[model samples]
Structures are given as C-alpha cells and as structure tokens.
Target: MNKDEQLKAAINQKLIETGERERLKELLRAKLIECGWKDQLKAHCKEDFKHKNTLYMDKIMWTIMQFK
Candidate 1:
C-alpha cells in the first residue's frame, strides 16, 4: 500500500479496534467527509456530506485505493 492507503488502513484498523459502534460511526462520517467523499456522498444521499457510515466506507476506500 502507498502512503494514503497505509494511512486509511491505519485509521480503519483503529476504528475497528475502538469497540464502540457510535464512536466508530461518528468518526467514519467525519473522516469520509474530510477525505473527499463528498461528491460520491452527494450522489449516494442526494446531499453533500450529510452523513456517512461503514456501509459505504469500504467502497469509497476501495475507490481511493485505485487512484495513483
């Protein structure tokens, strides 16, 4: 993995290890928005950066991993 992938992986691992579903959800939302998931997010929800969940995160992260 490259730096970005590594970083995302680290974050994902940490989030998984936290053992708190709400905390994980909140952080996943914030991180996804922060990391440019907005456009796709808008398409997914008909709004921009409104909310996020682990449901879409792996897909987004996979897309991210495909770049560069």
Candidate 2:
C-alpha cells in the first residue's frame, strides 16, 4: 500500500491494541479538536470507527495543518 494507507493501517492497529480504547479515542478526539477537525472527526466517528477511510480525509487535513 501507499504511505497514506500504511499510516492509516498503523493507526488502526494501534487503536485496536490500545487497552484504553475510550481513552485513546478521547485523546484523538481532543487532538482533532485542537487541530481544528473536531466536528468532522466526531461526525465521522459517530458512523463507525473501524472504517478508516471515513476519517482519512480529516486525518490528512489535520496532519497537514498540524505540521504546517
């Protein structure tokens, strides 16, 4: 897979392995909020968390903004 795909897979793996799923989810929620993607992230997560594709757009957008 491509770099983006790889990264998403990694995040998915981490989220799965994380014992505190709710905490990690909360952390991610906060980060997304701090990164200005809270609304989109929340709406996307409300649908399903396993569907990484749903959050890819917002994740990528947040990443770009965070590093810029």
Candidate 3:
C-alpha cells in the first residue's frame, strides 16, 4: 500500500486497539443529537422520501452535503 494508506491503516489499528473509535463515535452521536442535527437529518430524509417515493443513500448524503 502507499504511504498515506499505510498511515491510515496504522492510525485505525491504534484507534481500534485502544477502543477510541467507539468512544469517538458515541461522542459524535451525542453531539449530533444535542445540536438537533439528528432531527434535521431525519426530517430531510423523510422529505426526500416523500418526493421521490424511494430512498437512496448516496442521493440522500449528497443532498445533505449540499444542505450543509
């Protein structure tokens, strides 16, 4: 693998071994909920579903990134 990929793998391995990844995920979830980002994302998803009658993850994320 390239140097960048190798560095990413090493960092990910350290995070996993130390359980920091899960902790960071939990913290991010809590922060999103606290800031109403979770609710906003849910509303956006529901609105998109209503208009399209189908939910596509890639489309949803793209729209969300634009919205942000």
Top-scoring candidate (lDDT): 3
Model 3, span 1-68: residue lDDT tens: 99999999999999999999999999999999999998998887777668686667898788888665
| TM-score of each prediction | 0.32, 0.30, 0.80
Residue 62 deviation, candidate 3, in Å? 3.8
Instruction: Please give the RMSD to the true structure for each candidate, in Å.
Output: 10.8, 11.6, 1.9
Q: Say which candidate scores most in TM-score.
A: 3
User: Candidate 2 on 1-68: residue-level lDDT in tens?
Assistant: 99999999998888678766678778987897887776665555554545554557776566545542
The stretch of ten residues in a row with the least summed lDDT in candidate 2 is: 44-53
Worst 10 residues of 3 by lDDT: 46-55
lDDT of 1 at 57: 69
What value does the lDDT take at residue 60 in candidate 3? 79
Q: Where is model 1 more than 4 Å wrong at Cα?
A: 1-19, 43-68
